[model samples]
Target: MLSLTRLNRVRSMDAVNDTMIVEAGDTLLQAREQARAEGRVFPLQIGSQGSCQIGGNPSTNAGGTTVVRYGNMRDLVLGVEVVLPDGDVWDGLRALRKDNTGYDLKHLFIGGEGTLGIVTAAVLKLFPKPRSVTTAFLGFRSPDSALAFFTLLRQRVGQDVAAFELISSTALDLVLAHLATARSPLSLRAPWYVLVELASSRTPEDLENDFHEVMQEGLEDGSILDAAVAAAEAHAMAFWRIREEISDAQTRAGGSVRCDISVPLSKIPAFIEEACASVLKIAPDSRMVIYGHVGDGNVHFNPLRPVFESAADYLQRTSTAITTSVDAIAMAMNGSISAEHGVGVAKRDELLHVKSRVELEMAWRLKQAFDPKNLMNPGKFLPRLECVEALKS
Candidate 1:
């Protein structure tokens, strides 16, 4: 029932300190623009930046494309101002490089997903704006090959590599069919593709030389099957549209059993192969729509319903089993069941089966300590009955 949209404002902006105290309701796009206007950059580049609130972002610890270079929302935050459930405001919004006076309380709210309190405002870390940028759409034979090229590319470009995203042929086809402007960037029909972008404080010429050198090496080693380097800013944005519209495309293809998971960077190839196999074993004709931020080890491993399957029938027959199977595969590899996406209603109750007893207990204690009366976004990411009774007792 609470909305922060009207609270949107820039409380303060300290360019010299490379920090900004922004109200949580400010749209991410607005925050980014504010930083850019001041000759700095807010590097968290999620697809929903236009409307996604800055406060809600840290609630789930949203990680988008730039996570390869800038880390997640947790890393970008310096401090937060939270409203406790009992109606007291905790003003911990200190913008400093180091604060060792007490426990880092701001972190408790950053990824709390609204369970702890209301994040009304935050001090966000900003970086020096990139002086040069280049983007490329590349086709690869498989996930393994894409990873190999990614490794080689990183070796050459280092921190200049801002993003490395993996997209499947199936996922791209959905985007092309659903979105009018979406088009394939390369003629090659490889099973895997990567939308890689390089941004740096280095000069334009230096960055361009590195991009060309890495592309040549990838092509020579048979890692890059075909490539399309953006000739202009418009072309680059067009290429990015294909990645951004994937969720909409999935809905048009009929809904999918989505598994937002993450494994070790080295295990991405094997995880994809095993997870796809598991889905097929459950639903033989399900199309694997694999994609995600490869550099950060997160994968959006969704299985689209078979062409002939009814949406209702697909959910009835396979949704639970398919999600459980995919999650198990990720956990077996010492990975997480929830990556960028928070454990909302979809995976809330399922945490019991995956997390350890001690971990669950500690989480419960924190929830009880924060909101003992079970108010403030109750029944989220926790079992309803047990948590209520435990907090009261």
Candidate 2:
């Protein structure tokens, strides 16, 4: 791990081509800063940017809030240099925007979660940083209204919409109770809220005006119950802090059984409604902390233990059932059980249960081809398929 960390370096920066060559060990924050220095941007913004390494970002195909605009780590990476399990280095770091040479090998390891090999460095794609920005906290009667507001905002603003995050009232209460700096920006509280941002290379006045016009229409149409637009950069940061501090706030409440899942944007409200009902039926005392990137259909459905119940007892009784119920809803909606989080040991069995036989066989073959000896990050992403064969025998 020490050797891997030592690989941090910005090998090259071509501002003309809007590309940067950075080692995998460099923190995501480091990569963003380097791009900013060149008057460009690497727009993978996540709460863990300060400590999470670039290599791991691509390995997990991390999708942050900015994914609504800039896309995930997999889409941002142009090329990568990887070390095979047998210590052979495959240096395929090319910065060209159009390279259809062969099988697009870099993708094999992007979301592979280090199972195939070790990613040492990468050629990252960059974009022109947005000069003007505006953020707003909008209150909605429910997730369905929130989704409607999201669609309306996108239709009006188009690609300028940077982040569209959904926050439940439960999530907001947690932030206010636990986080000292947190405060409710809106005067009237609704059951749901959306933290939205608009950005462009144009002037701030233009962006602000456009945001105000759209919001006013939403208010008139009853899609928006109330709204608080950031008057300054500090105010925007405050609104964002509410979204960013959710995990910490949940931790402060008590440990939670969290499920990172995604479904069609249209099915979000139905999935939440059904899943919440299912969970309460199994554990009536469980508190559901629902939130996530609503624009992209990924939600973090977390069920916290009741204050009166012992943590060990609650988990032992309800953890598996709650997660299974939530995931089953997502799968039924043609969504994913593991969205951006990736399938580590925690979800290995869940993946096996969800994936088709052909998909599992293909994954097993890829594992065998890349790490034949089973030495690279073994028993993590892919489960032992031989067990299924043995059972049949």
Candidate closest to the true structure, highest lDDT: 1
lDDT of each residue in 1-393, candidate 2, tens digit only:
335777899999999999999998899999999999999989999889999998898899999898888888888999999999988999989998898878999999999999999889999999998989999999998898888878887887799999999999988988999998789999998989999999898899888888899889889988899999999889999999999999988877775889999999999999999999999999998887899998889899998888899778888999989989899999999999988899999999777678877788888888889889998888898878785344344
Which runs in model 1 stand beyond 4 Å of their true positions?
A: 385-393
Deviation (Å) of 42 in candidate 1: 0.6
lDDT of each: 0.91, 0.89
Candidate 2 lowest-lDDT run of ten: 384-393
lDDT of 2 at 361: 81
Q: Model 1 lDDT vs. the true structure?
A: 0.91
Please give the RMSD of candidate 2 to the true structure: 1.4
Candidate 1 lDDT, tens digit per residue, 209-310? Answer: 988988998899888899999989999999899999998789878759988999999999999999988889999999889899999999999999988989
Give the per-residue Cα lDDT of candidate 2 at 392: 42
User: Can you give the TM-score per candidate against the true fold?
Assistant: 0.97, 0.97
